[model samples]
Target: MATSEQMEAYSQFWSLTLGFAAPFALKAAVKLDIFNIVSKFSSEQGATLDEIIQELRIKHDADSIQAERLFRLLRFLVFKKVLALNGARYGLTPMSRLLVSHGSSSDVFVGGILSFCTSEVTQRSWQHVDAAIKRPGDSNAFVEAHGMEPQDYVAAHPEFWKVIEDFRLSISTATSATITRVYDGFKSVKRLVDVGGDTGSFLAQIVRLYPHIQAVNFDLPRVIANAPAYPGVENVPGDAMDFVPPGDGIFLKSFLHMFADADAAKIVKNCHSALESDGKIIICDMVMDEGKELHLQLDMMFLSGSQRYQRTKAGWKNLLESCGFGSVRFFEADPFSITEAIKN
Candidate 1:
């Protein structure tokens, strides 16, 4: 007979193996927008099946097998604390609030990250990781399978692009919320440039909130084409990896961790230079040190994106210091870790 130690080791192995189940749940939740759907389920009461069907304007019948199956899945989410259910109704938990209801506006960080990570196309990319491992390849799975970069693959494959667009739509509401949450911080700075600010959506939010703060929307020309005009805000098409707009403050919204350390340093160095010797950069990304187990699993799930997990505050501070910036301060901006760096 195997000893207790052997049994415990097997438990650990299966536990890791069952980690795939988490993403499967995430896939369903993102599709249902269950967080948002439940939030809208009459703030005073949880929803019933009929209520959910009506709210989402779906075609499924109340007693259909599909509906029953979906309800069962939702019950599981409630069990996991991802969705909160009360009697015949459903609602948000403290955690779901950071997702579905973004105080006032869309914080695409919540919407974007959740959707993209849970997507079918991205899921397929992870399957090739074992192949990547065996070959001594340059990439983990995504690049090896597609023979192209993530963005390149997306642009070239319409099927994958569909999911990306849908994913974008899922979190489209959160961009404004992100700005609303940090309006005070932006207002305090004289000149704030949003680096890699897609479509200038968040930049527009800042302009609407604080008319006095001069804003710059920084991104590639293709992305900036649809960016709306805001008074006192200049839209500049540029690569953040090579350069950043000169300003008193720089904003990076959910951008870092897309590259490995070497590339991250290149962008950090540019921001360090664009600022006054005393200027600070505002980074909106995960702070690994503050992460819970749920967040840790998420870091693992995104291994395909950059083969990088979220960085701890200490790690970030060390990174900034090495990149020619000093005097780092980490702040909790609700759902994201807002770190600041002063130019040396």
Candidate 2:
């Protein structure tokens, strides 16, 4: 009775409308530690529903009903490709592997971001996105929803701070690997400074690659106070908005996207001042490209949660050039892009 094309369009409309289902399912799996539990077994062997339930320590008087509900959840996850099913056993898929925490500080886990984004606080903030859009002058939806800035909220709630820290560490770990592989501009540097470097995690990786370079991990006093000593990396407590440490090469990874253009420019100007003659400043942030869905989605999140958004290539050029940098070059990288400029 219905045309095939018409049915297909209807299906797509429903899928887009119910898109929240997939991410919420993922959040549940991560919260239940499903990936980590299944990761203990080989894919070939996998983990049975019963075994998974045992690991979860789920107990009920009506065991069969509980198992059936969980099985349905797992089946949904398998359909989403977050998990794989071989016969009656379940295993972690490649996507699920990124969600598993191996208890390593350097390891990247999507769970933190997943948990943070799905939490009640974040969900409430999304409700005010319309308010943020209609409001005048740099209004943040999160601030409107929570009555405080994101950082202040995190500080107030220690649990959320841990989630934020985990998310940052995961992103920094992945970004550091890409930087060391694709960008060779660091080779000429004698001293390098990482602005807003959390616990020196990223700077540690850089110094490990180039032992000749002296590295400074610069951040606020509270952040630096918790930083462990990494060989060849000095933890310096300071604010980038006020003063950035002097260095021939200054790095800002996933930092500029946190501010509006004017504030970002001020930070860059500070980096320019701290640079020696002919010194370089390297930035790692999302440079929005046409048809890149992830970049656009991140831009939306920035729009709703803060007064920041991803920059386009022209925007990056304008910001850097205005801050007294020359010869800006952009490099393609996963999760983030690399931009390098030299002091004029």
Candidate 3:
């Protein structure tokens, strides 16, 4: 019933809509370790189905039927240009080569998306996107759809909790480049307090860099329960919302994005109060810009999953000002910012 121009628009829209198919396809590929196998085969000449199954040391039986299933999967990966197929052998494309194991380093390239997409909590919430978009105020999307909090369900089921933790540990590690870039000046910092510093993961680097600089790693008690006892680093279990330990430098990496404005304001205020006369607060969170295409997609992704959200440049400045922080400065080069301020 539409005109030619309208029909053309509709056709293009549907094609773009099919783009969602790629994420699921990629998730499946990563879950099956297809890319790692392909990359390994590339180092060898190439791998046939039997060779792939054997090399991967697959747990289950891989007979002719299973081999045929794997072949069909490889064909899809080949068609997607993530894997290269020469005659009957499979190899990795340049795009897929980054996922291979590096000596002993374990990097699951698509692990983040897989954990988010395939987690029982996230999977259940995916079914209610329409309801979430229609209904209005920001509520927990997972709870809204599933009728129970994701955390509660995760707590009740040990297997699901293990999967979630595996996904977190697999995805939370830093790339070497990112580590060097983010912590370029960490050696100069005198004393550091990592708020919500779950098990001293980020603080370990700082304490390692400056052997004398005391590190106070604060988080919920349960989170830092098994924290390793180190000489320069002190582990204390408590909520950052109610209180933060006093220190020279306050640090938070990717923790602020999990809180709403009021909660963030309180935490920042605590940080402001906790800092020594010459100290500053270090916030490492994604700053969103509406102008960038990728930023917009990331903004949407954050909105869909977590209730807490990113702040625009102006929004962050206002947030800082409201919390009695002065001299807010953002580094364009960094995904995070070292915003210095005083309590007046």
The C-alpha lDDT values of all candidates are 0.71, 0.85, 0.68
TM-score of each: 0.77, 0.90, 0.80
Q: In model 3, which runs have C-alpha deviations exceeding 4 angstroms? A: 1-8, 42-50, 53-59, 65-72, 75-98, 101-113, 133-138, 175-179, 209-212, 226-232, 332-344
Q: What is the lDDT of residue 306 in candidate 3?
A: 44
TM-score of 3: 0.80
Ranking by lDDT: 2, 1, 3
- Over 244-306, each residue of candidate 1 has an lDDT whose tens digit, in order, gives 889999988778867667889899999988997678888877787444875665565666543
The number of residue pairs in model 3 that clash at the backbone is: 0
Give the Cα-based TM-score of candidate 1 against the true structure: 0.77
Off by over 4 Å in 2: 1-9, 58-65, 103-107
Over 1-344, each residue of candidate 3 has an lDDT whose tens digit, in order, gives 89999999999999887866666777766767766666654454678887887855553344433667677777777888877778878877665654454432233343554556556566667667566667777665665766766567766765776666654444335322354454455565687888977667556666665677789989898778867776677899999888899987887777887878988989999888888875677676667777777667656655555465788878778877897777776654334444444444
Please report the candidate that would top TM-score against the real structure: 2
Better candidate number, 1 or 2, judged by lDDT: 2
Per-model clash counts, in order, read 11, 0, 0
Weakest 10 consecutive residues, lDDT, candidate 1? 101-110
Candidate 2's displacement at residue 57, Å, is 3.6
Candidate achieving higher lDDT, 1 or 3: 1
